[model samples]
Target chain A: MPDAHPPTRREVDVRGPRFAAWLTSAVLAVALLTGSGVLVAVQAAVFAVGALAGLRYAPYGVLFRVLVAPRLGPVREREPEAPPRFAQLVGLVFAVVGAAGYLAGAPLIGAVATGLALVAALLNAATGLCLGCELYLTVRRARPARTA
Target chain B: MLGGALALTALAAWWQRRRDGAVRGADDARGRTTTAVLEGLGVRPGEADLTVVQFSTAFCGPCRATRARLQQLQATRPGLAHLDVDAESHLDAVRELDVRRTPTLFYLDRAGTLLGRSSGAPRPDELTALVEAHVPAPGAREGRDV
Candidate 1:
């Protein structure tokens, strides 16, 4: 049989996601600091855009393309988009749960969830390790075998 | 709370630095012949002194870099072979081999014994050291450097 799966053809500069991760970390930090459900909700919307839409359409991604990419040197490396998109979905889940906890007057739950998201975003920003992306791979690997 | 969060993040970063991209001997592959697994993936174990089986997902950036590096190694090393497996499409082999993430590389000798495994992008010097230690010169019939 012909190769069933090929690497994703659409690629993004590695810097794009890293840049977005920095911005995400900052946003998540603020949300955690203020314990603001609204802020968490807003961040959730951002993640929703990235998850439901594509990473290319993410607000921070646009910011990177317009402002950051031009200032930096030419693209050094690129990567497939699926993993980060999956990461955004993961972030969205956390953000939604955090926002719900805050809105429901459960400060501890909100803090914990938002803190987890912040950690993940910070990891991506500082070290280029996407916890969500790693989770994505783990989930895929754990999936049941497709029946032939 | 914020201070606690930052400390936690720092701890995670430190842990990742210590763990990511380092190849370790595969305890799971110890003493087990992987000839069937390799054959299931259509790779013959006898063609080369060593075969590097890399499992990669589409979204993984380091996986691409790993592939390029392995391909480069294959070009330079006379008896080194590289096989790229799409982890998404080959879940069976992935599970059988206990692959956890993209760019998980399995080093196998000619008899299809799993020699080592790396879960992330490997360090260049360490990768070269492992290759030299495992893949003896073709047709020399020398024992492994171990």
Candidate 2:
């Protein structure tokens, strides 16, 4: 039988690192099937959720995909945890803060944490920067660069 | 997705923070006076910086916020300094920097090179970035006022 699935032309090529990014996102989505007060995984899921929200609510896809289209560039062989990596960092911090505040029964703290995280995330999407990335780079300066 | 929240944040949170007003025409008589007053202190290119000249007028509501933010940013960021020139005192600067908008940020490097400028209320992160890019690294020689 002939191959049922054939390669299709793309407006933006989703190959190489882009493909890895997409696949990792997909896998993360499947793994984070439950929100049940989960942390980092919930945010990875939030991107999926937010992308859908943007599609339905704003008629635009993810904010980064739309605004930073030029920066996304073509997929490469190397996959560095940079953009999503940073998002995960910020999101994880936000999750922890939120969880702690919730556990302590202080909605105010959770709200504050969410507020700050929102700033970092908004800056990333609008200004093409991630605060966590800067934080990560500064902290990891002493560590050896991973060959992987 | 993020933009949506930002849009809401601007409306709900930052709207009150925004100050609005038009730039005034120049007063040549006052321009020279400003330069003499601001010899050592730095200000935005074209816009003279005179700390003595604080610009808080009835017409300019966000003026204080802009000044505070500028002053606050200068504290954390390296070698970034600003001398505030009153929009009223130096109308000539208003004309030179084209301060057609109130609370317009006329940023300059420490030596007075006009690095970049924004004509509205600044985001906190944007303010940090502008300082990082424009401010002289600590211990670096200060260039002449550009």
Candidate 3:
């Protein structure tokens, strides 16, 4: 099958996504600790904005660009935006599920889903390795390559 | 709940760190899948003194980095070649080799023997050392033969 999404040429400073991950991890940690559906919902919205609205406009992206990027000096590295965007989508799925579970009184389900997202966020925050991005690549690899 | 997640995350991070870029000898379970896969890619055994076969996909960031590094290494070594295989396109080869992730690298010697394999972006020093050990210096083989 032809690639469903034509390759996007957009690239972002490599540090931007990592910075977002740090924030995400902290948010998820608080949500899990408090078992707060509202917190999970908020993070879900962040993930939704990131996956759908583009990273440049995402809240954490704005924070990184305005507050962090200025102090970091020149953009020494860049990466295509697709993988991390897909990762955001993956995080969104978990956050949404976790929110639903928490709000619906299924704390077990909430804990599981939220915990998974936390693990992924922690991986990205601490190591600059996105578990969601890795999952994206593995999923892509399982699909047939585009003929074109 | 938070403590459990933290513990799990810590364990995962430790495990991933241990495995990342660490080369291991070709396991016997793979049982000679390398030759057939290489041949399908138009490579015959012993064609190059050393071949670094890389399995990669389009969206993999580290795969791109690994490709650049391998390309640089190949450019510097007269007898070394780097082959980039689209893992998605070559599903059969990927399965045969049991490739679990992108940027899985197979290091092959002159006789096409699988020296080692590593999954994930390779460490620079280890990659360099592996290359030096496998690839002879310029005219070193010729001098030995003479």
Q: DockQ (C-alpha) of model 1? A: 0.49
Candidate 3, residue B10: Cα displacement in angstroms equals 1.2
Query: Residue by residue across A1-148, what tens digits does model 1's lDDT show?
Result: 1133374666788899899999988998998889999999999999999889898899999999999999999998888887788789999999999999999999899989999999999888898887876766678767788842
DockQ of 3: 0.34
Estimate, for each residue in A33-54, the C-alpha lDDT of model 2 and write its tens digit: 3222244335435544423332
Residue range B28-55, candidate 3, lDDT tens digits: 5453677557667665547677888887
TM per prediction:
0.89, 0.30, 0.88
Candidate with more favorable, higher lDDT: 2 or 3:
3
Candidate 1 has an lDDT of 0.81
Better of 2 and 3 by TM-score: 3
- Name the top lDDT candidate: 3
Task: Give the fraction of reference interface contacts each candidate recovers.
Answer: 0.51, 0.01, 0.40
User: What is the DockQ (computed on Cα atoms) for candidate 2?
Assistant: 0.02
Question: Where is model 1 more than 4 Å wrong at Cα?
Answer: A1-5, B27-29, B33-35, B135-146
Q: Tell me how candidate 2 scores on lDDT.
A: 0.41
